[model samples]
Target: MSNIIAIDSDIDRLARKLEHEARLFAARSRNAEAPRSRSWIVVDLEFLFDRSRYEAYSIAEGKDAEEKIRWPFHQVAAVCWMKMEFVRGEPVPMIEGPFVLAAGEMNERAMVSALFATLENNPDAIVTTWGGEARDLAVLRRAAATLDLQLPHQLIDGSPYARERLDLCRATCVQADSVHLPEMAAAVSVPSKPSPSKKIGVLCEAGDWSAVRDQVLADVLTTSVLAVRHLAAHREIECHRADTMTAIADATLSAIPTSGFARKTFAPWARGEKAASQLRGVVYRAAA
Candidate 1:
């Protein structure tokens, strides 16, 4: 049988290493000219697992039944993954295809090695993500801890930073006004249809896990577009606006109530203010 080790420990170690690298990167960025290139490297993560099959059953029925069941009822068995495009002030391409990790057999070490390999090859890159500050980055950090691997790049959670840097919430918080990542993709009217939902379970059920993963990457591309446009148009206000936009988006997504268990399972990622605050401090210090 494959060895089953606690993943949190690995995540702890990876977080430390990443924190170190992020500080270093922020320092370098501070010394660079203002209105820095919009180009950035991003890593997007999508986890896949069988929900209906693995979800725990309860004796009760309907809403009452669900109430009896524990939150995060399903255990994650595998993950579907991909890498994002890195460039300045342009929509980065979502790398084609995905790497699939089978349930109950993910080699944590191998996964971390692969992630680091990707990062090492792209030195001096600013890692970007939608909710990456809270979700994607933290998940990878945990995975690295589980695998005992060092992380590859400097991290930036574009969503929150964008809001804070650009004052988006106060200036542009209308739901109907600003387009969402998914909505932005639709507005652009990409030839391919956007995935049905961003939820991993929903995509897996539709047998479109790969497509969903790609959509997530595409969303990152949208983020890049918005990031650059905001920067170019309102160079002094982009970060605050982006952070507000991110906050708004997150609040909307969190209210969907698709899978109670999934909601609970991802609680930590959702509650990443602490980490985000810490990162912001690091950035400020690095800048100093």
Candidate 2:
């Protein structure tokens, strides 16, 4: 028999109870007009860029000189992946093959096209992500506006949305709740160390390609599985405590407010209501 590692027994039990609560919540939440089920599409974006070539554009110190100017063209390479997870079954991610686009390439259209393709298969699916509500989706929207693509699907941010509705963290913390990113990677048997790249470009450097790809995919898969577990069980694992299970649950719940923007943007989605804009406005206002 195959040995199955228990992700978390306590969280599992809590999840069962939570599922019961979720069902009741759903039942009460539904009016005569509400749909019987809510489908979801989770998305993650990966990009590879050559920073070596861009570093040559540095300017001498001066008021007129900018720190780092945007490249004339980004020499951008990107991949967008999606998966539809219902309340049941094994999750299979549908990934769009990586494409090379201009640094100036508008991403909004690409993101919308990718989402619409997923929606075409499941029209009722809500577009979701750990931080997509604040960051990823917003980036896509801006790119779409620049590229002229119409976004598809209603948006739901997993992190803040879950916190507001269920008092939980989004999938990232849930997946990493019981363990650190490195530990989670190990649990799933992913072979790559975390990168120091603060930006995707640096993260995706050619030197770190193999490890980065493995780590990124591992992170994505780990988070996806955690989200499914949360949905199915209704309770999160706290990973920080001495008791493995409680620690996992606590970690899962504690990850909710890590991002202020995510908290603000996803508040509506947690309540099972469509956000006025599939995207939520950023919490910090900056003069551009």
Question: C-alpha displacement of 216 in model 1, angstroms?
Answer: 3.3
lDDT (CA) for every model shown?
0.43, 0.41
Q: Mind sharing the TM-score for model 1?
A: 0.42
Error at 58, model 2, angstroms: 9.8
Residue-by-residue lDDT tens digits, candidate 2, 126-173: 554445444455555555455666545343333445422222134446
Best by lDDT: 1
Tell me the RMSD of model 1 versus the true structure: 21.2
lDDT of 1 at 96: 24
Best by TM-score: 2
Candidate 1 lDDT, 151-269, residue by residue in tens: 66443233445421222222333454643445554453221124454465566445553454445444443454454444446542233323333342343244333422223322333
Once fitted onto the true fold, the runs of candidate 1 whose alpha carbons sit more than 4 angstroms away are: 1-38, 49-112, 153-180, 184-193, 198-200, 205-210, 236-288
